[model samples]
Target: MGTPTDEDDGVAVALRDAVRTLTLDSPHNRNALSSRLVTRLYEELDRAEADPGTRAVLLTHTGNTFCAGADLSEASARDAPTDAPLGLAGLLRTLVAFPKPVVARVTGHVRAGGTGLLAACDISVAGPGATFAFTEARIGVAPAVISMPVLPRTDPRAVARYYLTGERFDAREAARIGLVTCAADDPDEALAPVLDGLRRGSPQGLAASKQLVTREVLAAFDRDTDTLAELSARLFASDEAREGMTAFLERREPEWAVRQTPAR
Candidate 1:
């Protein structure tokens, strides 16, 4: 394992054989997609892409929650920018279009935009401890931006249920619904053969093969990213979203969610 980068960097790169494992290290916020973390991830990805020795990239996390989605604290700030969805869209596109195979090792909870990250990967292995949800609707926003990557890979019925209900599901369901490639009790052991195969693959063959499978996903990005990102920005800026986000941060139900008693 390679030496980790500065802890503040939010991402750590470890190289073993030809695989570059990029670990999401920002456990402070459950590896949420903050602006800083996203920027750092882009930088690390660029390095891996430019490195000829890197045959594949493995994405994982340091904490129990693989990723909890967007940084609600940042999103709820008074001066928060509304371009988060645009940045997230670009990152997802990068993963989908990456020349080398991008794989995910998810062993914890994933929510909202984090699910997009998993969907964008060419292959993902989820451990027994992994759980996933499309929780955007619960926060008063549609899973619009993530839908670009997710809808192409997941079952339409499963997508509808999760996106609309924001309900959590286990790793097996994730695999069954096409969200993850496989679910395993020992993810690392299961990943060993996959990584070995990737390491032995020719660079040209790997890149070409990835391109074949990613065309549909890339097309979705081209067709819907702009519109979806704009929709996300608009939704995040609305009054209902403000109330929802605030309520979430405050650990209380939003006013709209509170039940009213009938007058006697």
Candidate 2:
């Protein structure tokens, strides 16, 4: 029932009895959190909430990379000067306050804002080979808006290291730091039990339970998002950030990356 089908295109939506399966299908950009994609995700979540049959939601991706964070292309193209990432912030809020249990099926690697998406989920099961990173630092911006959901789930020391370094960590390390629920060789097998249990719950029971459990997460979003989103937008548009993003897109070391001096 909850299987991939033809409709599994970009932001695929499927119903398996009471479970609403939402797949991120833009593999070209590795499911980058473009404003377009974020908007579609919000709509899907709305659909899931409105449908009484949707007792749970499973958010999965379509390609090797789960999500590569915000579309740098869009942020770099600040020609239009819009509130680019605020939509992403809104999407995260929608996920946090979502009524039903949201599950993330992590297939491969995740980065920056992608980590935030996973953190917002009620449960995230990742495969053994899947890697994770908070990469915004590499581009000269902090993981601002994402920090709302991400910080609450992860260890402070871990966040301090990864948030500043942008280093890739394996799924096991992610699980240890509480970024993921657990790492498994077979994510589907691990998620089966969780899905089965969620499917058995009545709509109101699932909704109320999720609200009660995630009340703190919702509170965090309410209190912190406006300021964080502003910081993210400002950083993304800064001179240094532009240079960092340009260097990344050009496949070269960013200007801020220091050159190694000869050993004394």
Q: Name the candidate that leads on TM-score.
A: 1
Q: Report clash pairs, candidate 2.
A: none
Mark the regions of model 2 whose C-alpha exceeds 4 Å error after superposition.
1-9, 261-264
lDDT of each: 0.91, 0.86
TM-score of 2: 0.94
lDDT of 1 by residue, 37-88 (tens): 9999899899999999889999999889999999999988878897899999
Each prediction's RMSD to truth = 2.3, 1.8
Model 2, 24-133: lDDT tens digits are 88988889988778878877888888887778889988779899998888789868345766777788888888878899999788998999999999999999778999
Best by lDDT: 1
Structure candidate 1, residue pairs in collision: none
For residue 143, what is the lDDT in candidate 2?
A: 95
